[model samples]
Target: MTQAQQLREAILAAPLETSNFGETPQPGTLYLPLSHLKALRLDAHVVVGGRGVGKSFWTAALQSEPLRRLLGLAASELKGMEVHAGFSIAEHIDNYPNADVFDAFLAEGGDPYDLWRAVVLRWIARQAGKIIPHDSWPHTVAWLKQNPEDVARLMQQPRNWKGLILFDALDRTSADWRRMDSIVQGLLRTTLWLKAYPGLYAKVFLRDDQAERTVFNFTDASKLTATKAELKWARHDLHGLLWQRLINAPDTHGEILRDICRSTQQENVWHVAPEMKSESDPQRKAFETLAGPWMGRDKRRGVPYTWSVSHLSDGRGQTSPRSFLAAIRQAAEDSLERYPSHEYALHYESIKRGIQKASEIRVQEMAEDYPWVPKTLAVLSGMNVPMDFDIVREKWENAPAGALEGNPTRLPAQHIDRGWDGVREDLQRLGLLETKKDGRIDMPDLYRVGFGLGRKGGVKPKG
Candidate 1:
């Protein structure tokens, strides 16, 4: 077989799926970006990121002793530290409260600060093989509030170990914005209080919107805010991640890829290292070997390496590594099926189809995190972006307001309470929509393609 045939077969077999990272990340497959190092610090209390940006990935990684030790190579602070989950998407009723328990606690006029303290006390009790009120939240809160000195004494008891408590999927604690904010605020207050005792720390993973809300209303919220880090991906970071996955492909593909992109051996694991200062240069060349230099037949259509990422960016100019990888995977699959005899493994048209696939995946994720967004956006399908704001409002007005049909009524849709203007602002904040310089509203291709919106000259779905 020719080299093109081998590359095509290899591309078809490359392991490019990112959905598992959102669920339970495989430690062996993780690509720790340089920017994420700050987030791994023990002192970095708050980790803010958009959906699919490795919040859950880190939450799982930190829980595993072996993984944490491996990660310590990148961030030396993690070595020898004890880690525990304060709360996670995977339910652990004994360790933390769920949505029902939180609602009951609030309904009884319980203080969030005191309630969170009770959670910490439970962990302490478990360590000492002692029992506290586990049957009732109110009883637990009463015990914690009534015996502050006892709690302090228990926490102060010297231990030979240092521990880090991680909290992710806090969104599962409550659906209501106000209630979730209160619970998070209380948790943050408790995290701050934990600092009084050495060797104990709290690391929270929060959505970008959740971090910007009223969770910091109380005094000294800045203590945690000051050390906050966002899980952002740069252009190079995204390309870097692509190569990291590429080199790990099955033997037929991996051997050829290992030659083109150089790697370093550390702890017997092969890590793809940057070959040039630009970083983009090596990444571009690696991709060119598969898709060629231009997106189409010539340069006017743009370079595949740059065009793929730029087009996938959200309204805020952030591109998710999830979407980037998904598009490339889809592009390769499409090329193998539709353009089998082409010179390149990935065709320009196939790349456009890949964006469509990524947009669809993004929409599904948005529905899971912000259910009401689809309720509002589905009405605007086929509408061109950068249109007058008033025109956009009229579309929403005509659209059905079934925002609460399947969601909890108490938990408002991310910003549905603020009306159309509020929803628009929230969308822009989440990078789903943008306000162009001329005051018209525009949708990024990432969201636009999936939501069925169109631009004068843009990729359209296969129907």
Candidate 2:
């Protein structure tokens, strides 16, 4: 076996992990894209992004002291700063209430605003070595509502306690759109309430849809909105993240990848250079060594460097590090099995297969986020896209009504009653589909291949 084969095996074996729901990402897994710098600062109160874009990843990362120190490399304010989660992916009943508690609290005619303030009052009390109500969520909330003076004293009780409180996975707050909106709005209002105290801050990680709603309807909400940051990944950022994981691969694979990347060992882990973090010649040249220049026989076939990221993009033209890395790992496996003697670690054809794998994963994510998505998209699975909306509408109309049935708790199409146009709008908002310039509907390969849709001269869905 040659070094290229070894590289293929190495790439095949790379951990390449993405969001593990709520697990703390390894220190070596830290690759702070320059774009995310503002999102991690102690001051940014509201961070928004679509799925697979590091919303949860950052939530878990900021919880670890070591990871926070690593993040301090980009944002100096994070070093040694205390951190806590008001709400997160992980369940910590002692720290905050879970979805069921929230549902029950609201079901009993509780205002979300009072419930959230109760959550903060408890955190402040615990830090100050003072006891507050904790028998149940409603119990604490009752204490908060009943004793305004004590709550005020606890909130203002001057202490050296200074830190950032994070709230994430807000979708779990409630399944119903209206209630979820109120709950999120309540949290934001609570965050705004926290703004009065110096040195105490709250950061809320919200989904794009959640952030776009009436959650910011409260007075002084602009204070949080003004500091809002978006989590995004550029074409180069995805490649940069891939090499970060590859260079830090264990043992010999790590050494091999580090050599290709010219990575130097730093802080007990391989550090990707500044050049690799951007769309510079060094970054482009590095990927070419693994994937080769052209995606096909020659230049006329298109450049592999640009083609891979472009094809994996969502309807909004965003390429997430999660999807990009998953596709690359699958690509390496395909290249090894099908083209063992190929000049590069990733063959053009194998790259195509990787898209399908990533698409399937993305599709699963969409279904989980919106259970109605799969059935809705399934109505047009066998058809080609970039077609007229009328044609797509006709297909959905003829389908069984049960096809659109959704889980009782999960949200359905925003305009389910408004008909196909509403469903189309929902899909577009979710990055599943887009309207072309000419009003023809199109689906990005990220979703298209997974939904089993065909495209003219485009990557095909798995047979």
Candidate 3:
């Protein structure tokens, strides 16, 4: 095999699956974006971000002792802090209530606030070795509600260690938005309730849509909202993460890639230099080593370093690391198969094809999250964006009666009662569609290509 083929092999070994990738990311695959530092701090009560932006990743990473120690290098407050999952995708009936327990409790006219408080109280009870009701969730909640003084004494008692409680994947707690909103609001109230104790901290991971709801309408909601941190990845941060993973590939592959990128190894993990973490000449030169200088025969085609990411951004000007890394991996595979003899591991043409592959994967993730999204967006598949809203609304209205039917068991179509306008707003909020200054609708190439939408002078969707 030639050098390009070998490099492709090295790139293939990096983690590409983002959505359903295992909860605990291996230590070697870790990369910290400067923008995410505040979100990882103990005091940030609410962390919000788009899908595939590392909310779930951090939820699991914070639980690992080794990962916490590594993250501590950047945020010293995380060192030696006890982390526990109060409510997460990884459901533990003993630690917290599951969907069924929540459903049953709420069905019986139980308050979600008391249930969440019970979750924290149980964690503290275990730590303090005080026996309460261990039989079931309802039993625990009943005990807490029945004994106010006992709960207050346990909460106010000082301890030598500080604890961090995490809550994520809250959408799984309920299907309907109204119920989900109530549950979320209750959790926030409980998070505010946690503030009274100096030794305990609460961190809640929420999606942007969830944050925009009435969950924060309750008393003292601003206390948690004030400490909100958004999880974002900058352009250089994406490249930094790419090199971080590239340099840590298995065995000889790691040695070769690390040598090309010129990364630093410390504590048995590779890191991109500070200069490489920005759009410096060094960062450009590093990517050029693998994909070459220009995206085409000359500079007229634009630089591969910037073109690759710019093409993958959504309409909101946000590009998830999941999209970027997935595109690179696909590009490497395409280059190896179609242009093994090419001078670089990632050919310009192959990079374009990588965007197509990444878009397809992203659409699949959307389907899993909101099954109604694919069906609704399918109507505009062949149409071009940046067109007038009336035309799009006409298309939506002209579709079959069953086309827009929503699944209430999942996240139902947002604001369906308001008709096509509501759907338009929902899509815009999701970074899938944007309204131009003239009120024309726009879709980003990240979703446009996969969803089979057209844009003038843009990457064409597959026939």
What's the best-to-worst order under lDDT?
Answer: 2, 3, 1
lDDT of 2 by residue, 374-452 (tens): 9988989889988899999898889986886878888767767778888898888878889988989999999999999
RMSD of 1: 2.2
- Scanning candidate 3 in windows of ten residues, the lowest lDDT window is 14-23
lDDT of 3 by residue, 1-463 (tens): 8887788888988655565332788777777887888898778999998889998888888888888777656758878788899988776889988888888999999999999999999999888888899799999999998999999999988788889999998988988888889899999999999998997999999998999989999888888888899988888899988998888888888888877776777678776677777878888888988899898899999889999999999878999988999999999999988998998889999999999988998888888788788888898989987899899888888989888776666888668778888888888888888888997988999999999999998878877
Task: State TM-scores per candidate.
Answer: 0.94, 0.98, 0.97
Off by over 4 Å in 3: 20-22
For model 2, the superposed segments whose C-alpha errors exceed 4 Å read none
lDDT of 2: 0.87
Pairing residues by index, what is the TM-score of model 3? Answer: 0.97
| TM-score pick, better of 2 and 3 | 2
Please report, in order, the local distance difference test score of every candidate based on alpha carbons. Answer: 0.81, 0.87, 0.87
Evaluate model 3: give its lDDT. Answer: 0.87
